[model samples]
Target chain A: MFGVTILGNNSAIPAYDRHPTAQVVTLNEQLFLLDCGEATQMQLSRYKVRRSRINYILISHLHGDHYFGLIGLITSMGLLGREHPLHIYAPAPLQGILQAQLDVAAIVLPFPLHFHALQQEGVLVAEDKFSIECFAVYHRIECWGFIIRENRKPRKINKEQALAYNIPGYFYERLKNGDDYEPRNGETVKNEWVTIPNTPGRSYAYCADTIFNPEVAAKIKGVTMAYHEATYLDNLIERAANRFHSTSKQAATIARLAGIKQLLIGHFSSKYEALEPFLTEAQSIFPNTQLALEGVSYRIL
Target chain B: MFGVTILGNNSAIPAYDRHPTAQVVTLNEQLFLLDCGEATQMQLSRYKVRRSRINYILISHLHGDHYFGLIGLITSMGLLGREHPLHIYAPAPLQGILQAQLDVAAIVLPFPLHFHALQQEGVLVAEDKFSIECFAVYHRIECWGFIIRENRKPRKINKEQALAYNIPGYFYERLKNGDDYEPRNGETVKNEWVTIPNTPGRSYAYCADTIFNPEVAAKIKGVTMAYHEATYLDNLIERAANRFHSTSKQAATIARLAGIKQLLIGHFSSKYEALEPFLTEAQSIFPNTQLALEGVSYRIL
Candidate 1:
């Protein structure tokens, strides 16, 4: 049920039938927007991604290719009569920018918009079932990478065993929490005997616009999958470094070092007309590497 | 040689395979961008419009649908190493918004970007071959409409007559300027004998994002073609008025009043799946009415 859908996969200049950097991270019924580039809202609708279900938006940096479509999405939400509060996590300056635009247009949102500035990278979101942690990355401007991990699920109760023990149905919630069943006879039934652990939770890491930095590999280690920017091929390593971007080989190497189960590479430069070379280059280094194609959803198993 | 290519035609919410308002006005070799909505750069590329030739961009209002794609287009120009200067005519607030984004991204353009704020309605560009003027429009915000007019062409020279008159090849320029040739013998070669007037110049008016306002009809009179925003159908006249938008019938009425030869109606509401009703409604009043389909060029005859 947890997956990442790619809305756009191109780099600074959107060309060759590809768009800029934007994606949707789906965790069950809730959707989290990742780096909304231009036309992201349209792409969401095109892919049948429910815009109303998206309550969280995470922006990696101030690059136009990364977040130019944010204001439009926000405005569209208001026009569509979204009543639920939306949360945006981005650089501090983004709040002022959004506020200025809204003020000039004299637009009052129908819902509340909460802005959470990413001044210092840490645990930005922590819930009972999942958590999101952000860490700094090497880029020309302020940027960060995020790791979303689903917490271990609670134990499942054995319904037949509970009924046989004469446990009341109203106490199922407590039983799922590893509580023993106690009847009026003053006899206590063991919790482990009537319950079993649920399946293990999965994790996904998003490495946004960044150069080749191997130091953060440990932070993303053992994740179900990792998405890293491969803006150029290995032949243009100098160009990639100058632009504060990453090469396919460099991204794949980091994914291999981090022991990720699947490696997704995208944010391709407009100079490249063919994306097959990027997949080839990355797979040469990490055999599990896959090209991040637009509109395709990569499940985190 | 003068035409407008539609990039997007939907209203506030881009859906149902349509996009927001965006168009490219082509005057021979030059292209002027009009109301750059989301993913305008992609549309320009899709239509094979020369991005390098687009030296001017006109933004009608502060609405996100009108200009949300501007920053991305400008940034892409810089990333593509555009050395020619780009001029943008928009509301005063847009310059600051673009500057803030560029500053935060730490991106310095390779070319000069000139911002001309549209505080009043006046002529923005006056060249020998063409001229562009902006006029106020009745919208929710401080919006403006653009009128692009190709200048009166020069006279076509009769090469045989000029050669027989012993008129120097260098004097051909003067001949086109409606000047008669004179030899040392004091015999004047009448201008009428050597040249004929070229075809009359054509004009196209863009009435961007506005409600029905009859006062400005005189300003656009005698235009070859006009593009008006038909945001809603006749049935939603109340809704259109509440949102400061216009219906197809209203747009047609204005086009007819302005004496326009051809009328293009667009900026359709996303609520409707079919656009045929818009054409039918508009054409009922103005027979020359046409639907502004994306990638279709409406030539000013």
Candidate 2:
């Protein structure tokens, strides 16, 4: 199953039992950690996320709220005897930070940590099952965003159609994947006659801390699911823009402009105790908007 | 008001709702944080600790469980615009680590942070009200422990005796501080006649991470309270020694040998779930032993 779980939704400061930004994106058997905040390790335990399965970590920036938990999580992974190679994609400076932290503590990780400094905004990882892409965002300092695209879905098999076509049972496997079957009798059976078209591949976009920029929308247009930062209410539009953050309405505007299927809004400011205003405001512009609550999983339909 | 609150009790990994080693020592109005582990900031919030009120942070070692949350807490303090100077006492390498992290993120702290490298085992801070001292411990790497000594307690003023002695209200304040009252035209009244002796100011010692060493007891003898790390049970004594940790019985032995009035034992290994066995084993050797439960305050009487 493919889904995204919110580990922490708060911004810079941890308040109201809400933590800083961190999320767990599970695609098949692999888990991708996007922006590990200070509480990421503990939150992973709270949400029962298998740490060993997290093969990739994508950090948007060097901001403390975005990647302070990287060293701790990596240390714990070492302590747990994880041998799998962990790949980290982040800003160029993170490699130095991680090295200094580990060197000072004399920690030798048991796994091979491949640090891929995100210098440009493009594909970071491309596997047979999925692909990951990064893009630049307008922020106070150097920052970036990420989007994950899953592999194409398999064609659905029609049992009645397959039997009616008199195709051999052994060829049904290929038929379900849109492959034409040719019997020894010199008769060709078209794939469309036995299988129906399944839905296309799904995509999830993570727009890390950024201002109200339509370019962000243009980069990740028509995504199946998108998580946008709504750091403030509509009333604080000026305050949000001045700090290089976005308000609920601005996030919703981007979602509406991008024409995405669903919008998940989070990165709430510590000043606000109630998140209902953000959801209600965002939903006015984007009807399929939902608050990114901690521990709640959002699956792209 | 002189008490120690446990923010985290677990040793290396966070388990069973327990975090790593972090404690809040409240001395009158001042709060001193000891060994900030991964969840220190969140645990501080969970227990309603005023983050701004903490003036001193003491880190014993460079272990991730001992000081992983240092940067996060400092960053949060900076974001909150704390102007008062914060003092951090840890090993020398931590300064480089902190500098690298702050430089990469371009975070200019609002407050002045004074980093005091712990080199020699001696007095780190000596004030009129309290004194903080550090000592070396037996760990895998270079580690140190801290002991806080409060100033002498004031004499309790005996109201009836003061009235009988004809001491004026203005002179009572001085009398409580063990000062003899000299009237304008009369003979001096002895301090003992007006005031009775109060209990002496208490002392609390923290033995961070160490093997079973009898010298630890000799260093902190007669302390009002002492907290020692007990990473395993008595059966795992060999394992504890190999890891440079202490078993429950060993921690209790040190407490008993030191003749401390009370003992608070923590730093439990993640392998154990139920803590009752630890309490039972420690109490068998030291009757005044208590499990260092998170969020609970243990006052030094």
Candidate 3:
């Protein structure tokens, strides 16, 4: 269940049935919001993603299209009687903006809001299940990217081998946690006897709102899946560079250089009504590129 | 043509097929946005309303469902390269919130932003074609309703009578302005001889997020069309009162007592999946009642 669902894929202005930047990274039952833009909550409702399960929000920058929907989503969560504390990780200035909006509306949340200002390139959240880290990106303003690494799963049990060893079905849950089996006859079985090691944990990196920078490839090197902003086509390479955005070719180049297993490209400019050209252009450079479409989820593993 | 286009028609939470409150008051080529909520810009785009033509935005309250989309719309307008100045009318606290967001985002609008805080019950805007007035409403927070009154039109020209008078075709425009005609022979023609009095101008009042207050009828007396919040049906009268909201029956009663030609009831509570009951209940009280459907325009002729 380690996947990312696209809520909106358009760039600054939402057009042509495309919305601004917003995504939901799903890990089992937990959901983490990435860059909540306008209509993010509506998208969540439309896509049937449980808003109550979204306890953490990661905002890349202070752009209005990136985080304008945060206030409304937070307020709606309060109205929905959410008592679970919410955590928001963004640039430092977001706290003042959120506070002013809450105070103006006289909204006293039913839950506490924890704000974590992203300052340097380091881990923002480290839990037993996963960890999220931030890295710098070359944008017009100060911005950062995020990488989420899910913790490695425990060994898988061989049901036939476990049955032969007289292990009850109830003990399977503990066995998956790398616990050794103990029979009533005082015979202790090693964990390796009936279990096989799990594959490596998956990692996904989100390179938000960046220009064509080679450093990005080095920062997100060797990720299982990578999402890059391809705001323009190759024809608008100069425009993309001037606006601190990346072209489809540029995004693909970075993904190919980083050796990512898959590249999800989005944040498309509203000018391009047809999206086929983006896929065609990126695929010509990197065969593993995929278009980030609304309501579509790309599994990291 | 003067009309009111419904953008959203639900209460605090957007659910089912209904959205939060938002409307566009159309006056010929210009538009006046009223209470922009979440997904309002999307609604505007969906309904094919020219967002660039919207020069004025009126927020009735500080509720997130009423004004959360304002900042997004403004930012989008800037991104779309709007050069015309935009006017916004809301409570005083909204300025601080908007400013903090803009400061953090470092967004300098290409167009000027004119902010008018709604402090008193008086005329907020008075133009040659129309005038807008604000009045207090009974809500949980400080709120106001708006009245858009079209200016008195000139006399309608009688074509046959003008032809008999031998008036030139070029003089018809002036004749509609109530101008007298004179021939080269120096014989003055009276305006009444070739013109008839124009019909009375139309007035529409928006009673935003209010309780079942009988006093509201007096404030919006004699309006051509009136829109009032019907957040609940007759069965939830007690709940409506507790939440400082009006039921469908209450809304219709206010419209009937105000001598309105037609009543438009909206701001439906999201708890109800079906909306036909609201219209049925309101029409039973006021025969000229209509349910405000999104994307539908109610012409005031």
Candidate 4:
């Protein structure tokens, strides 16, 4: 299953009720953390997210609201006796910060830490059954948005057709790979006659901490789900632009232009007590829009 | 008026029900933070401690459990448009770490930040109605303990003697300063006959994150209240020694040696779910010992 869980959704200042920016993206059994804000570990525990399964962390920027919880989480992992290697992908400067904190505390993790610096734009940071591509976003600091796509599955074979043709069990693998074989009697068959092509894989794009830029529409085209930051309302359009952040309408416009199936918007200003207006404004432009509420889970499909 | 409010009392690993180390030292209207752990700003809000009134912050060490919340707190203060200057007393390396985070986010506080580095032992960090002194402690890192003493008040004059001698208001100041009063008529009055000595002031010592070291007893002698770390039980004596931490018995012994009126011990290991044993073990050595419960206020006098 491919999905994303909102750990925290508020902007710069974390309030008593709303928290800062943090999200957990689940790809099958492995979990990938996106932008760990302060109290993210608590949020993980509060929401019952198993932190032991997290193998990768992706930091969008160096803002405190984006990554302040990193040191605490790393320390907790060590204390909990995590032995598996953890991978971190972020801007180059984050390594120095993390190293300094660990060094001061005299903490030596049992697990190996592999840091992949996102110095240049349009690079593939990680890939496996799922591929994550990083692209530049317009922000006050160096920030990048991630596009995650699940690998396509093998073609499915028609059991009735294969059985009627008397295909051997050993030839099933070849048939799924679009190859058809003849039996000992030299009977031949076309691969398309028994197997159907696999369905298109789903894709999700996370546009982290960015201003409303039409250029982003080209990068996230045809995605199944897209999470764009909408930190303010239309009334605070000038303030949003000054802070290099997007509004609800602008985020929805990008999702509409990108042809994404669903749009989830969050990172609201602390001044906003109610988030219904954000959903209303975005849904006016894109009917498939939803609010990124904390502890809420959205399936990628 | 002189007391401490426990903001967080848990050990290194923060649990959902408990938090990491943090305390608010309230001296009249001013508030001083002691060991701000991760999410301390939220803890401050949860306990209704006014973060805006905090004028000073004392960092015991560079452990993430002690100072990780500082950057987020400072960032939130700036975002809230705090105009008052904040003073931070910590080791030298913290300055670079704090500056790097601030530089990355391009956040400039509206108030001035005065960073006082603890280089040598027995340095007086602050002096006002209460004098703060710092002394080195036995820890894995360069840690320091703080001693806060309320300044002694002037000696009170004997009202009956003063009225009979017709002492003027101008001359009362000299009498309080231990000087004999000489009237304009050339009559000399002995200072002891006119004024009585003031009462001795109270003091609180915070021996934060330290091992059971005898040297600390001399520095915290005659303190009214002492807050020491008891990270393990007697059974884990070897582990406590290896980690440069103290057990409940060791902390109680130090409190007894220091002759403190009351002892508050905390920083329980995460391995143990209950804290009753800590209090029991400590009270065996020091009868005035108490456990540091979160959100609880303890009087220094």
Candidate 5:
């Protein structure tokens, strides 16, 4: 039920065949966007991702490659008569930029748009059945990585045990919560006889637009899946550093150090004509690494 | 050599097969961009238009679909190490937006970027061998249409008559300027005896994002070719009016009234699955009208 869909994977300048950074994370029925590059709207349509289904967007930085398509997407949603409220989480500067563009066009949205500013690192941006946390990453501008964790469900109650104890339906809730029930006759019930512990929740981390920083490894440790940017080859390590980006090997190193179950590496530099070298480089360091190909979906579990 | 190459032709919402508004006007070796939509850099590459050859960009307004691609394109050019100066002509507000984006990226151009503000309707945004003039257009924002006129050359001189009159090579410039020449030996050369009048110049007018207005017609009168926006169909006339856009019929009306030699209409509504109706509707009023098909080039002559 939890997965990530790649909309665009190329880094820096978008090429004719490859687009800039953009991805869609589907958590159950809800959709959240990550880094909307130019042509993201087209990519969404190309992948058959319903624009109306997207309720939240997470922007990593103010770079054009990361957020240029946001205004266009918002405008198109308005034009299409989308009535669903949308929330965007990004740096505070993005609000002014979006507001100025909207004001210039004299457009009034039919739905509400909420902007949540990511002013400091290590803040819990949103939490519900799924929780999202933001932490700073090393980039040319202000940027953050996100960790999304699904909330664990309560333990399952043993119906046979409850029935044998002559417990009513109302007492089943207490059993699921690891609480033992007492009947009106003062008969006690053991917790172990009624319920079993809940299964562990899966987690996914998105390290958006950042250079290789060892500090991030601890924060993303033991996640089910992690999407780390690999914007350059190992040979271009200096170039990657100069651009405040990471090489394929560096991305794999982070994933390996974090002990993540699987690694998805993308954001290939535009200078690269083929992606085989990136995969080779990353897999050499982390055997569980995979290339982030466009339109491909990867399950969290 | 006077033709327009469709870089992008879709409306605000870009489709997988179609893009937002963007086109390239090719005048011999020179290229001028019109309405740079999102992902225009990729579109330019897809259409095989040399990014280095684009010297001028004319923005119609502050709409995201019209100018969002500009920053990305500029950034790409910078990354590619392009040294050619780029000139952008748009309303005053656009300068701030573009500058802010460039500043955010901390990009210093290898070439100069000149911003010309178009505040009013009239003569001369740029004048050289090719003269560019901006005329007021009826749009929701402060918009202008561009008229590019290739300067006419003077007629060739009669070699035999020039030799007989012993006209110096230095006097050839004067002779081309339609002045009678007097030789050092007191011989007079009549202006008409040695040179014939020059041929008429070619002109192309870009009527960007606008509603049909009679005033626009008069300003663009006698243009050899005109590119007009047809954003909606007749059934959506009310919507077009509300959006300050034109239907195919309205675009044709302006072309017909302006007495243009030919008309190219694009920026079709995404609701339209086919463009036959637009061409048919426009040609009903102006027989020379043609649909602006992407990747298709149309000669002005």
Candidate 6:
């Protein structure tokens, strides 16, 4: 089950019940929070997202709309008696800011918190099945974008053939790894006789708050799913450029340039109450575009 | 129209749709925000409280549930192009915290901010119609409580008598101040003939997070309306004492001991879903007690 859940999708100001930017990426058994904005914890609760299951938090920037809800969420985690280790990947100054908040309240967390400063664009998390990488994006201040890719090669086992060969059910994982089964009767069952190659793993990219830059498109090329910020429509191209944001047309252009399968656009400006125009603009450029609505999950297929 | 609107009333963790502690005090033409918790800005929006009208903010403690929304609210104000000055009265360390947040984002607020540290906690604001004072409260950490008093003595003018005296409408303010009005016709209208003394001004006290202490009741005696934190019910008195929090019965006792006309009990524990027991426990001791429901305005009369 690989998908991205939209918790909040608004920009700097919250309007029309649209909250700031926050997204949860589910890759198999792991959950990674992309960006935590103000009231994100409330959104998480409203959507019935399990806060305890989240182990990784990646902050894209230091904007108040991006990381203001971080303190409340983390403190609530401690109050809920979370004992597992939590990891945070963000800019250098975030460490001091979090420390100051903890110092002021004199809070001693029950869980081990690992802070990874984002200096260079590289791998952030490397697990057995998936890996998350961070890359620089063009914003007014220092910012970053993240991509999570499933990096495993597994084979699909033929159940009929395995059962006919009298193979045990518990050896399916080894069969998927292309291992031959040796039964108690000393009969050798070849791996290729019952196994075939499976489909390749998928990936999802979170293009956190960036301008219209082809370099960003080049970095996340050929991703299965991509989320880009379309803060304004095409008519407000100058305004989007001046604010270091992207328009709907620009976001769709990047998605098309990167050859992504599915494109999700969000971070709508508070000035916009009707979002159909944003959809029209993006879909005109890229047909596989969808509006990132809160509480809705888009499958990474 | 002097009253308090409860924005949030939950304790450390938000549950059952109740948020953290934050209140908006409407004193005539001025608005004062008390203890901005996480998502307080969203609450202000939900309650239709004009964020632009809030000129003063008072933070009681350094708890994350108390002040996590400060940065988001102020930054949104800046983004909305607020030009009026905003005053923040909090602990000394808060100044550095705000500075660090602003430095990371490189945000230059459009309005000038005044930070008044609550060192001794005496007179926070002294205006013509009202005066707000801060006092120490017994909490786990250094906390403070606040009381707002209407200071001016106003006189009620007799409309019939003023019409007979041929007094213009502009002379009403002077008449309220016990000043005799002289018409252009050279007839002196004595203040005693047309005006009568009105009732004394009302007062509201906000006893922030604290334990059961008689000293706090002594500080806010004779207040018209008082809001005390009731973090637990009577059954959890030992837990309340351990956490330096007050139970429902204790909050009512403080109100009764202080001779308050009305009592509001809130800051409910997240463990409880139903809040009717809180009102029942408090009203059992003090009949005028009411539960502080979010978005409900409790008049200071």
CA lDDT of each candidate? 0.91, 0.93, 0.92, 0.89, 0.87, 0.94
Instruction: For residues B1-301, write the lDDT of model 6, one tens digit per residue.
Output: 8999999999999898999999999998999999999999999999899999999999999999999999999999999999999999998899999999999999999999999999895888888899999999999888999998998578999999998888889989889988998777787889999998898889989998999999999999999999999999999999999999999999999999999999999999999999999999999999999999999998888
For model 3, the local distance difference test gives 0.92
Q: What is each candidate's fraction of native interface contacts (fnat)?
A: 0.83, 0.71, 0.75, 0.90, 0.60, 0.90
* Candidate 6: clashing pairs of residues: none
Model 4 CA lDDT for position A259: 94
Arrange candidates, best TM-score first: 5, 4, 1, 6, 2, 3
Candidate 4 per-residue lDDT, tens place, A165-209, comes to: 888888999998778777677768888888888987888899999
My TM-score estimates for the predictions, one after another, are: 0.90, 0.90, 0.89, 0.94, 0.94, 0.90
Model 2, A191-254: lDDT tens digits are 9888998888999999999999999999999999999999999999999999999999999999
Give the Å shift of residue A191 in candidate 6.
10
lDDT of 6 by residue, A160-274 (tens): 8988888899999999988999887887999999998888879999998999999999999999999999999998999999999999999999999999999999999999999
Clashing pairs in 3: none
TM-score of the second chain, cand. 6: 0.88
Instruction: List candidate 1 segments past 4 Å from native.
Output: A156-172, A178-197, B155-198
Give interface RMSD, per candidate. 0.8, 1.0, 1.1, 0.8, 1.4, 0.6
Task: Give per-residue CA lDDT, model 5, range B49-166, as digits (tens).
Answer: 9989999998888877888888889988988898878999887888777777777667787888999888777665555568788888888888888988887777678888888778
Residue-pair clashes per candidate: 0, 0, 0, 0, 0, 0
Worst 10 residues of 2 chain B by lDDT: B193-202
Model 1: C-alpha RMSD to truth? 3.6
Chain B TM-score (each prediction, in order):
0.90, 0.90, 0.89, 0.94, 0.91, 0.88
Q: For residues B224-285, could you state the per-residue lDDT of candidate 4 as single tens digits?
A: 99999999999999999999999999999999999989999988888888999999999999
True lDDT of residue B209, candidate 6 = 94
Cα shift from native, residue B68, model 3 (Å): 0.8
Q: Which docking band does candidate 4 fall into?
A: high
lDDT for B135 (candidate 2): 93
Please tell me how candidate 5 rates in CAPRI terms. medium
Comparing candidate 4 with candidate 6, which one achieves the higher lDDT? 6
Error (Å) of candidate 6 at residue A166 is 17
Candidate that scores best on DockQ? 4
